[model samples]
Target: MFVLDLIPAPTLRDVADILFLTFVTYQLYVWFRETRALRVLIGLLVLGAIYSLAKMWGFFLTTRVFQILWQVLLILLLILFQSEIRQVLEKVSPLRFLRTRKRSFHGAFVKSLIRTVFELADEKTGALIVLVRNDNPDEFIHSGHTIMALPESSLIKTIFSRHTPAHDGAIILSQDYITQMGCVLPLSEKKGIPEQYGTRHRAAVGISEKTDAVCIVVSEERSEVSTVTAGEIKTWEEPEHLAKQLKDWLGITESPSVKPKEYLKLAFVKNWGAKLGALAMVSVAWLILASQQEVKIDMIAQVKHVNIPAELILGPHSAKSVSLTLSGSRNSIKALKAQGVGVYVDLERLSSGTHQILLSAKNIDLPLGISVNNVRPKSIRINLEPLKKKVR
Candidate 1:
């Protein structure tokens, strides 16, 4: 009998959250790839890495640049990925990315691709067909007709046919189905686009830039079958090779066939990867949560035997920079909100042996999110003696 060890296992809830967030990140990847902003993203990532290194090594300037750029980047990202962001949200009508996207056979998807290529090459029908990958093509599909799913060969041939309704626009995909025809995709906005690039070629590059999807275009003017990925297009003629390429990209080609024992090892490793990723995410989440918590601390003015009065409490002393030393909780190390607590001691009134004063603060209940572990100086102790007379 084999007994499974659950020791050191991470919680399932954390795992699920990790996977869901991972899937969302994947979808975002597809959305961001191959676009103008993709280069910027890479540059930013590189800069971030450099900043991390600089901080480790004490290169203050590099760290400053990285920190400063972040201030402007948020606005720029929104502007650059405007269309793509909208397209992705539209595709996730019901938030499917919150869980795993189960793979189903996108049948007829390949056949249609093959047929379209053959016809476009033979008859020189300028056409583009886009396969939605990690991102959604809904925004692009809005410009065309939403049809019931159709067989690939028939759909491709008809779309390229001279008399067909969608001959001018691109075909769009969703969930392994041919969901739309004659879809209007954003045109390539790069200034260096070829002089001869017509609507079809531009659309192909445009969609490829904006999404991780594979786009196939048959150039009517050249009788060429070109594939576009990450905003770059490449041409080819071999149908068999193309089929193999599709399968490989979609991961149907030669998946590692491991033995049961090997499979167990792989699965465990995969789960470990997932757990590690989750822990990283959890750390970030914890920081965000801790920041937002009502966790607060109050600084205590380290004083002895001096009774603080109402006047000092209401106003500041002659020294603009007051040196206060007090403690309430761990949060006190960096922050002590005025509303959380306040104290003022009458520095002149002290001729003391020992004195006790009640400590008070507003909302000592700690706003909402943080718990106070320890209160420093539960009683202020003052050791007092009679004031000595000054010699004339």
Candidate 2:
């Protein structure tokens, strides 16, 4: 009989970990590549670098100013990237994730889709496809013709070929299917989109603002490809480069798996620089609650043993020592003092063996056993001189 391999594979685990990081790094990178906030993000990084240098060099005042600015910059980035982040989250939604890989990527059929993109780009074809995410874009889809899912290259080429019946309008890519063709997205009227950007870019930005879907544009005149998410679009991108970008945004990467470290990093903030506002909000909540509650009250006191002159039977036998501490309402605690607190046990009643005691303060009272359970006392020593037994 052959024995099974019992040894751990260190190399395999390391490979798995690295592969996880590669996927995460790529995913984080792609999500930020084309959005309008990329510049501001760079600026934030520079500020962070400066802040780090200031900290290292003991420039406390300069670092303090940077710290404040960094806080604001962080919030703006979140608002700026909200649309793109929404799109990526839609891809991660459980209902959409497992069901769409066959149609979206990994399937050999996607190769045909890539081929069609190349063909469109080579011929300087202009087109827009707005993918609907999570929340239904039924209103947007109603504006266009409905179609059953079709094979990649042929159908994509047919629509944008300049010869097809619906070439003028944009396609709507929904989970596992292109549910409609020629969908008309409301063009973003906001001034944020540059005037030089074409309708293709406009539609990409528009649909992204309205929904969490990513928009891909193949510019006919420029022969350039761009993607829009979260109300921001980047143009003049190469088709190959855009492919990697989408793959990363779509949760595909050079590595097929995820790692614990990457998952944790992604969990807090795929971009930590962008999450301080949320943290500040939490801090504000804590402050508000703290301001309303009791202050300066921390502990209560308890008795250990009792001493009496009447009982001659006093030896090591004594009730367990109880610790007294300051506690309760602010006024009560403020008035309390170690002198005001006193431990008392009825020695006449206590048997020769042991007895419980009471600890009382200006307004505080503790049950017989509570004090010892709570506080560890430094010392509670009671010496008793037995009451002179009247010589009878």
Candidate 3:
């Protein structure tokens, strides 16, 4: 039978547990996709596959080696992806709310940002603007003039003008305000960045890689606008497209009319490869984890004699224990072990004679989702004797 058929219907808690695991897995997949940790994750998965196959095929040496590695895998992951792990913890920190409150950038702010970028692009003036999200970029801002002024298109344009002192540096915008200007951001050390892209583009990507910030960069050489986030850059050819992207990232929602085909095309057809890959990975993982529901394990349970008749005595019992095989999910089996499972033979109403008691499925007490499949030495022979009167 299939695993799902063998398993009982899920409870509300079980559903919640599954949903929580799925959400965590999806988020981790997304996070790994943008970092150097992705390659490490792929390598680990490949090793895991090999290990599984080795164990299945009875490659004892390989299996033993992999088993040893599994013991330290958690520590190895922690040491290898320490930075990524720190970033995740920082993002989920409760103290973050106390440190800074995130204010949604209004439509006016998005429009201003878009206008400023296009105006700078037209003048062939290089500008880098970093929009701070949950993470604070204050530490990355060095040798910068702190203005903490409300953002305006004219002010932004003036700061990045060719003649201005702050023109060469980046601007930091936080909580819908320009927190700093003329800020020097870290240059990206990542390889494969195009040689043609100058310090401004590198700074944009660098700050984005370090924090959850949306960076907008304007190229002086090409008069082009681009967005850098999560170490990825996308250049925009048209001002309208840049503006739409800015609005989308800045939480400025615009309800535009869309046809059914257009909706389908955007949702499914675009980036179909990534969508399909994600679905396949999640489905495979779920199946492998859930298939343990049908797993069976054999255990020996000692038979306990309970509630003996006062006038009778158990002279001899043929079978003191029975071999039992149980089928259930891994978790259920673990719980059964923890709770101390056992088999019991009741002999309270038996008369003074030898009798054979047949064991069956009904004789065992198991937890929900667990079922008894087979019991060895199905019957136990017991000889009972009447108690003789004795002098006090």
User: Considering every candidate listed, which one attains the maximal TM-score?
Assistant: 3
Candidate 2's TM-score: 0.44
As a whole number from 0 to 100, the lDDT of residue 162 in candidate 2 is: 83
Q: Tell me the lDDT of candidate 2.
A: 0.59
Clashes of each: 10, 10, 0
Instruction: Rate residue 175 of model 1 by lDDT.
Output: 66
Candidate 3 Cα errors over 4 Å, as ranges = 1-27, 58-61, 71-73, 87-116, 133-135, 139-143, 150-167, 186-196, 209-212, 229-248, 251-272, 278-379, 382-392
Clashing residue pairs in candidate 1, if any?
300-325, 300-326, 305-382, 352-383, 352-384, 352-385, 353-383, 353-384, 354-384, 355-382
Worst 10-residue lDDT window for candidate 3 reads: 1-10
Q: Per lDDT, what order, best first?
A: 3, 1, 2
lDDT (Cα, tens digit) per residue for candidate 1, span 219-264: 8888888788877767778887787777655545555567999888
Worst 10 residues of 1 by lDDT: 1-10
Compare candidates 2 and 3 on TM-score and give the better one.
3
Instruction: Report how far residue 292 has shifted in candidate 1, in Å.
Output: 17
- What TM-score does each of the candidates earn? 0.46, 0.44, 0.58
Over 1-392, each residue of candidate 2 has an lDDT whose tens digit, in order, gives 11122221225654465445545444654555555545555576467667766765679899889878878877876787776567667656787756644324343444455566667878888788765555466654446788878647777888887888788788876654677887777676546566667776777776676576777788777776677887777764455666666666554565457899999978667756445443443344333333223434334334433345345655554434454444343323334433344455545554443333333341234322222223334433443444456676
